[model samples]
Target: MALPASSFPTLLFFLFLISHPRCEAAESFSHYCSYNRPTTPAISKSIAKVLSALVSKNPPKRLNTVSFGGGKSKVFGLAQCHRDINATECKSCIEDATAQLPHLCPGQADAGAWFDHCFVAYDHERVPEQHGTGF
Candidate 1:
């Protein structure tokens, strides 16, 4: 038997939904890693510290900046989630971004990743201000 005309639109809508999946918060969009490699073990340690801090902090407003160590060994990091997403999603996205950065940009002095719901970056120097610039 043939389906009624009333069900055609509903069926098409479902098909479209299935064909075009929504972007997940943890889905990676793009990434960048600086050409400058870490010159000392201290900087590498700092990078790990800052990245760990970023994941542990879990900003309530969905944006955070973290720093570790001092002087030449200093490492700075920034994590920001899209305002549309909730805090839990923001946290999860940040976690994923942090986990991927080390593998995505190994030994680099600065690296960044952009995901569907958030952005994460770290550098030996201070990370650039991400506020009020429309990212």
Candidate 2:
């Protein structure tokens, strides 16, 4: 059986907020956790915390981004907490999404997720276009 996908407009806001890669910086109005491996242990830990909450079913519903180590060209990701999700629920959804990505993508280093809604993947391509977001 196949699962259906959903989109949260909040994600667009998340994307809009993004600029360069500032793994160390965070915003109060948003919840962004990133893992910058090969350096920045603090960042990795921050990311882990968010991931843990996500899988546990307590997602922030504002989990806007999940970026991997940029040094790994094939590694990068983006996930949005469900708009309707409360902080706790959003965390949970993202955790599940994060865990499944590696297995689902297998070998592919780059993957993006639409929490409780969609998951997009690409390697040599930019972020995958969301439904009706246009390709």
Candidate 3:
């Protein structure tokens, strides 16, 4: 059976719509956030202060781990940027990440957020030092 010319164009258009790929920008990259016990008001304040400092003044090397407060109220924090990224871009990414961390994790004592180009983490206890791998 032969189709009419108008019908052929309509069919072709539908086929093209389905066969062609859709172009779009990729969603921003992020990592999982682990939630632990809630912190006391003092500890929470310390965490916020340290994280704010990290965002405001990123280290020269782009990797920084610091501790704030003392005793039970102490908080540990770390921030890092991809080595390939420039200082300005790294700072921007860290700033964005720090801004989002509290919202994403709420009151959790231990939380971490990772972006495509940067990462941030905070906890009540210090991050353990890694030993040499035997395997």
* lDDT top scorer: 1
Model 3, residue 135: C-alpha shift (Å): 22
1 or 3, which is superior by TM-score?
1
List candidate 2 segments past 4 Å from native: 1-63, 70-74, 112-135
The sequence of per-residue lDDT tens digits that candidate 1 reaches over residues 1-135 is 999999999999999999888964365678887876653799889888988999998768677888989999998999888888888888898889898888888888788888878888888877845634244
Candidate 3 wrong stretches, greater than 4 Å: 1-28, 128-135
lDDT of 2 by residue, 55-93 (tens): 543333342433333443423234555354466544544
lDDT of 2 at 98: 65
Sorted by TM-score, highest first, which candidate order results? 1, 3, 2
- Candidates 1 and 2 compared by lDDT, better number: 1
Evaluate model 2: give its lDDT.
Answer: 0.40
Top candidate on TM-score is 1
Report every candidate's CA lDDT. 0.82, 0.40, 0.73
Q: Give Cα distance to truth, residue 20, candidate 2, Å.
A: 46
Q: Put the candidates in lDDT order, highest first.
A: 1, 3, 2
Q: Give all TM-scores, in the order shown.
A: 0.74, 0.41, 0.69
C-alpha RMSD of each candidate structure in angstroms? 5.7, 17.9, 7.6
Worst 10 residues of 2 by lDDT: 25-34
Using lDDT as the yardstick, the better of models 1 and 3 is 1
